[model samples]
Target: MAQDRALLRVEREEVLGYLLLDSATVKGDSVRYEGRNANSHNDVDAIRGIVRSQVLAQRMERDGIDPKRVAAFARFPLEMHTQRIDDKGRDRGVQLGLIFLGYAVALLLYMMIVIYGQAIMRSVLEEKTTRVAEVVVSSVNTDILLAGKILGVGLVAITQVLSWVVLSIAAMKYGAQYIFGEQVQAAAVATAAGSPGAGGSPGLGLLAVGLPPVPLWATVALFLCFVLGFIFYASLFAAVGAMVNSQEDVQQAATPVMLLLVSSVIFMGPIMANPGSAMARTMSMLPTSAPIIMPLRITLVPVPWIEVVGALAGVAAACAASIWLSGRIYRVGLLMYGKKPSLGELARWIKYAR
Candidate 1:
């Protein structure tokens, strides 16, 4: 048994299924083996080649032919690529670069909302706890102060996002040069320009050479979506912060907003897999989710101008409402420092502001 293991070069644990082993056996010129199921195409093909060798040897020996008299060669190599289904019943190729580009953009918006909104919330909490609000509000209108804070922090967030965009572009353009050099660049461009038969797309060929997948317009839309989404959510965060006196209270106050942000991220998987699906299209129009889903749809599939315009209008309206309501709550809440106010109390504060 030990000798068999030595010959197989497979550990005892592998036989027990604790680990996987690629193995074969030879007996009386007959070969038997289980092919290794590896992730790589070449490895799988090689295993299939090994399986075919036994039949080839049997035919040769039956004919009383020497192995030296027979040879096998491939006329040409087989290449594999994926294609996209187009509008006119034609299959193009999926552009992985654009898919991931959209994913990155959507993810960035999610992070900015969750992270910077928390920052805004924390800033508001600090100013109130420290009594800094008294001195600051003495001169400045509370609404203006709230707007200024949201805008200032939002500008910082936008700057960081833009930096990431520039860095990503630089990495794709220059990193390819650094890694593959001029020779690889020429080959990739050539492959992208060529057709991969009638059934497959050449997009993957370009992706293999590190070419950018998304168009310029998608990037622009990604930025625009993030900007509008940030303002809409940040205003809510400021209100949540104002309603609470401490960080612990902020969590309880901000639960609904947090869930909304998280739901946007959760919806990303389905949207990316089927951007043209009815559900994805519907979510892309919702103001709460549009910031994340719309960009994903725009990046992965073709979206109509009407849906885009309607979504923008919806977000603008939501933003306006959040700012107006949050500003009133923030003004009243900043001065009330005892026990956290109830929802009814918050409503009264908004009414008082009006």
Candidate 2:
């Protein structure tokens, strides 16, 4: 009777073992066969089934895919793939083109305005100290002499500005793509599409647009403003040089003018941050500060026609006043030398100089 019960228990366990083995095989067909003995076979099959199911569950968890929950799977990584450009010869050619064109233009403009303007002032001062102006005045009218000096210096500055502009255009045409990169090009295109008649930004977009596509009217306005501003400052610088007997005196006299220029640039940060503010509007209309402020306002934000006209008129008036003042100072001081003139003396010179 005992032997019959043991045999029955063994038979029931065999049936359960076979079912577990079949399930394990379905999940993974790499299950190991322990032996043909009934007890050994049953233990191996049960262990294999449990192990396989646990591994599958862990894998699902790691991938954020729960067995009991439904979710969509990502088909690819979350980064954009782009092909690299490997045209070494083309890249080299573009780089050289940019160096020759872009750098040349920027350097020329700087040298013309800053370097030559200083040269004019120094020349005037040297001639005045040496009393050469008295001899020149005997042969030529004072106004004629002034006109010749202004014209000669102005021509040099103009030539430099033109050369730079030409070179900059050439650089943009040849090497802009390589310099600015693909992302910048895309942004420029997007910006242009959004803002019609605007030359998006300075870097890549400026290069891509070249010369023809730029806003001609705006460019012309800026150029005119720059010319007027330079003339006004240069005349003042020449007058200051004449008033002083030495370079040290010239430096002291020119401090206020330099400060004015520096202050205008410093204010640009705040103006740009809040373009529509009353402060910005007022500063933009001031002749002394308008050259820098007006251009920034027009380029960065929506500027009203009235403000533009007001700024232009104010700057033009200031330039005219500066020319008159400079001419008066030059007429009197260009013959005086030795000691630097005081403020009171300068006022008298302007009041009484023929």
* Pairs that collide, model 1: 84-92, 84-93
Per-residue error for 121 in candidate 2, Å, reads 1.6
Local accuracy of candidate 2 as per-residue lDDT tens digits, 1-354: 643343344344432212223443434434322211212223444555565666455546676775455223211111111111111111111221222332332233334545665776888888887878889978987656766787788887778677766776677676676776775567456434532123444345445544322245556656666676677777777888788888778778888876766676677666655555688788878877677667665544335678887788888888888888888988888888778888899999999978
The clash count of every prediction, one per candidate, is 2, 1
lDDT score, residue 146, model 2? 69
lDDT, candidate 1, 1-354, per-residue tens: 644443243222232111212222222222222211111234335544654555456556766676455663212232223223222221133355556667877898899888999899999999999999989999999989998998999999989988987886777667756765655455565555533232233433443445345546656666668888999999999999888988788899999999888998888886676676688888998999999899878766556678888888888888889889999999999888988999899989999984
Per-prediction TM-score to the true structure, in the order listed: 0.70, 0.61
Residue 254's lDDT within candidate 1 is: 94
Candidate achieving the largest TM-score: 1
For model 1, the stretches where C-alpha displacement exceeds 4 angstroms are 1-94, 180-220
Once all C-alphas are superposed, what RMSD does model 1 give against the true structure?
14.5
